[model samples]
Target: MNARREGDAAVQSYRRAQQRLRDGGKDVSSEQRLIRIEDALDALLDGLVKQREQIGSGVAVDVAGHTLAARARSRR
Candidate 1:
C-alpha cells in the first residue's frame, strides 16, 4: 500500500485501540496491542516532524509529494 493508505490504516488502528482501552480493556493482551500501536504511530509522528523540519529549512522532502505542507507553497 501507499503511504496515504498506510497512514489511514494507522489512524484506524489507533482509534480501535483507544476505544478498546477506554472500554475497560485492561487485560494483558489489550495493553500489549495498545503499546504496539502507540510505538508504531509514534514513529509515524516522528517522520512527519522530520519532514516539517526539512520544509522549514528550505528543503522539499515530501516523499509522497501530496502532503498539505507540499501544497502550502502553491496555494499562496
Candidate 2:
C-alpha cells in the first residue's frame, strides 16, 4: 500500500491499543507501555509529515525547472 495509507493504519492501531490499555485499568506498567506507544506514534507521524513535505518540495522544484526551460526556449 501507499505510504500515507500505511501510516494511517499504524496510527489507528496504536490508538486502539492505547484505548484498550486505558480501559483495562490504571496499572503503572500498562501506562508506561501506553506512553511508549504514544511516543512512537508521534515520531512516526512526524516522519511522515517530513516525507510529505519533501515530496511536495521536489514536485515544486520539477515544476520550476520546466517553467525555466520553457522560458529559455521562448527567448531562443
Instruction: Quote the positional error of residue 13 for candidate 2 in Å.
Output: 19
Candidate 1 runs further than 4 Å off: 1-28, 59-76
TM-score of each: 0.37, 0.61
lDDT of 1 by residue, 1-76 (tens): 2444445555665565555445534465866877766766675665565444545444333443557756887888
Candidate 2 weakest lDDT stretch, 10 residues? 17-26
Winning model by TM-score: 2
Q: Which residue pairs come into collision in candidate 1?
A: none
Cα error of candidate 1 at position 40, Å: 1.2
lDDT (Cα, tens digit) per residue for candidate 2, span 1-76: 2545555655665565555445534555766777766766676666566557556666777898999999999999
TM-score of 1: 0.37
lDDT of each: 0.55, 0.64
| Model 2 error, position 23 (Å) | 23
After TM-score superposition, what is the CA distance of residue 46 in candidate 1 from its true location, in Å? 0.9
